[model samples]
Target: VVVVVVIVVIVVVVGVVVVIVVVLGSNGGNVVVVVVVVVIEVVLVIVVVILLQVVL
Candidate 1:
Protein backbone atom coordinates (compact mmCIF):
# COMPACT_ATOMS: atom_id res chain seq x y z
CA VAL A 1 0.00 0.00 0.00
CA VAL A 2 0.99 3.64 -0.20
CA VAL A 3 1.53 3.84 3.57
CA VAL A 4 4.02 0.99 3.56
CA VAL A 5 5.91 2.52 0.68
CA VAL A 6 6.11 5.85 2.45
CA ILE A 7 7.57 4.28 5.60
CA VAL A 8 10.13 2.35 3.59
CA VAL A 9 11.23 5.52 1.81
CA ILE A 10 11.49 7.38 5.09
CA VAL A 11 13.69 4.67 6.57
CA VAL A 12 16.02 4.67 3.59
CA VAL A 13 16.29 8.45 3.58
CA VAL A 14 17.09 8.52 7.30
CA GLY A 15 19.75 5.85 6.87
CA VAL A 16 21.43 7.81 4.11
CA VAL A 17 21.32 10.99 6.17
CA VAL A 18 22.85 9.24 9.16
CA VAL A 19 25.66 7.79 7.07
CA ILE A 20 26.45 11.19 5.57
CA VAL A 21 26.44 12.89 8.98
CA VAL A 22 28.66 10.17 10.45
CA VAL A 23 31.20 10.15 7.60
CA LEU A 24 32.04 13.70 8.66
CA GLY A 25 33.42 12.36 11.99
CA SER A 26 35.46 9.56 10.45
CA ASN A 27 38.96 10.49 9.34
CA GLY A 28 39.64 7.06 7.88
CA GLY A 29 36.15 7.21 6.36
CA ASN A 30 35.34 4.04 8.27
CA VAL A 31 34.37 3.55 11.88
CA VAL A 32 32.53 0.43 13.11
CA VAL A 33 31.07 2.08 16.18
CA VAL A 34 29.80 5.04 14.25
CA VAL A 35 28.13 2.77 11.73
CA VAL A 36 26.42 0.76 14.43
CA VAL A 37 25.25 3.90 16.23
CA VAL A 38 23.84 5.33 13.05
CA VAL A 39 21.95 2.14 12.28
CA ILE A 40 20.44 1.88 15.75
CA GLU A 41 19.52 5.56 15.84
CA VAL A 42 17.90 5.39 12.45
CA VAL A 43 15.92 2.27 13.32
CA LEU A 44 14.76 3.72 16.61
CA VAL A 45 13.77 7.02 15.06
CA ILE A 46 11.87 5.35 12.27
CA VAL A 47 9.98 3.04 14.60
CA VAL A 48 9.04 5.90 16.91
CA VAL A 49 7.96 8.05 13.99
CA ILE A 50 5.82 5.31 12.50
CA LEU A 51 4.23 4.59 15.85
CA LEU A 52 3.39 8.25 16.31
CA GLN A 53 1.85 8.40 12.88
CA VAL A 54 -0.34 5.41 13.67
CA VAL A 55 -1.44 6.74 17.03
CA LEU A 56 -2.59 10.09 15.75
Candidate 2:
Protein backbone atom coordinates (compact mmCIF):
# COMPACT_ATOMS: atom_id res chain seq x y z
CA VAL A 1 0.00 0.00 0.00
CA VAL A 2 2.76 2.44 0.87
CA VAL A 3 4.66 1.52 -2.22
CA VAL A 4 1.63 2.12 -4.41
CA VAL A 5 1.15 5.55 -2.92
CA VAL A 6 4.79 6.44 -3.48
CA ILE A 7 4.63 5.31 -7.10
CA VAL A 8 1.50 7.31 -7.74
CA VAL A 9 3.08 10.43 -6.27
CA ILE A 10 6.18 9.98 -8.36
CA VAL A 11 4.15 9.49 -11.52
CA VAL A 12 2.11 12.61 -10.85
CA VAL A 13 5.22 14.67 -10.18
CA VAL A 14 6.90 13.44 -13.37
CA GLY A 15 3.79 14.09 -15.42
CA VAL A 16 3.54 17.65 -14.12
CA VAL A 17 7.20 18.30 -14.77
CA VAL A 18 6.88 16.98 -18.33
CA VAL A 19 3.93 19.26 -18.98
CA ILE A 20 5.86 22.24 -17.63
CA VAL A 21 8.86 21.38 -19.78
CA VAL A 22 6.70 21.16 -22.89
CA VAL A 23 5.08 24.51 -22.17
CA LEU A 24 8.41 26.18 -21.49
CA GLY A 25 9.95 24.61 -24.55
CA SER A 26 7.14 25.91 -26.73
CA ASN A 27 7.64 29.36 -25.24
CA GLY A 28 11.28 29.38 -26.31
CA GLY A 29 12.81 28.90 -22.89
CA ASN A 30 16.51 27.98 -22.67
CA VAL A 31 17.35 24.36 -23.44
CA VAL A 32 19.89 24.24 -20.64
CA VAL A 33 17.32 25.34 -18.08
CA VAL A 34 14.93 22.64 -19.23
CA VAL A 35 17.59 19.99 -19.07
CA VAL A 36 18.64 21.03 -15.58
CA VAL A 37 15.08 21.05 -14.32
CA VAL A 38 14.47 17.60 -15.77
CA VAL A 39 17.64 16.24 -14.24
CA ILE A 40 16.80 17.62 -10.81
CA GLU A 41 13.31 16.22 -10.93
CA VAL A 42 14.54 12.79 -11.92
CA VAL A 43 17.03 12.78 -9.09
CA LEU A 44 14.33 13.79 -6.64
CA VAL A 45 12.09 10.96 -7.77
CA ILE A 46 14.87 8.44 -7.45
CA VAL A 47 15.77 9.66 -3.97
CA VAL A 48 12.17 9.50 -2.81
CA VAL A 49 11.78 5.96 -4.11
CA ILE A 50 14.96 4.81 -2.45
CA LEU A 51 13.99 6.35 0.87
CA LEU A 52 10.57 4.76 0.73
CA GLN A 53 12.10 1.38 0.00
CA VAL A 54 14.34 1.65 3.04
CA VAL A 55 11.49 2.77 5.27
CA LEU A 56 9.07 0.08 4.17
What lDDT would candidate 2 get against the real structure? 0.70
Q: Kindly give the number of clashing pairs for every candidate.
A: 0, 0
lDDT of 2 by residue, 1-56 (tens): 56766776877677677767676666556565667766776776787778778878
lDDT (Cα, tens digit) per residue for candidate 1, span 1-56: 46855766777777777677778776664677567867776776687678768876
Candidate 2 has which clashing residue pairs, if any? Answer: none
Error of 2 at 29 (Å): 6.4
Error in Å for residue 29 of model 1:
10
Candidate 2's C-alpha runs over 4 A off are: 1-29
Name the lDDT value of residue 2 in candidate 1.
Answer: 63
Q: What is the lDDT of every predicted structure here?
A: 0.71, 0.70
Worst 10 residues of 1 by lDDT: 25-34
Quick one: best lDDT, which candidate? 1
RMSD versus native structure for model 1: 6.1
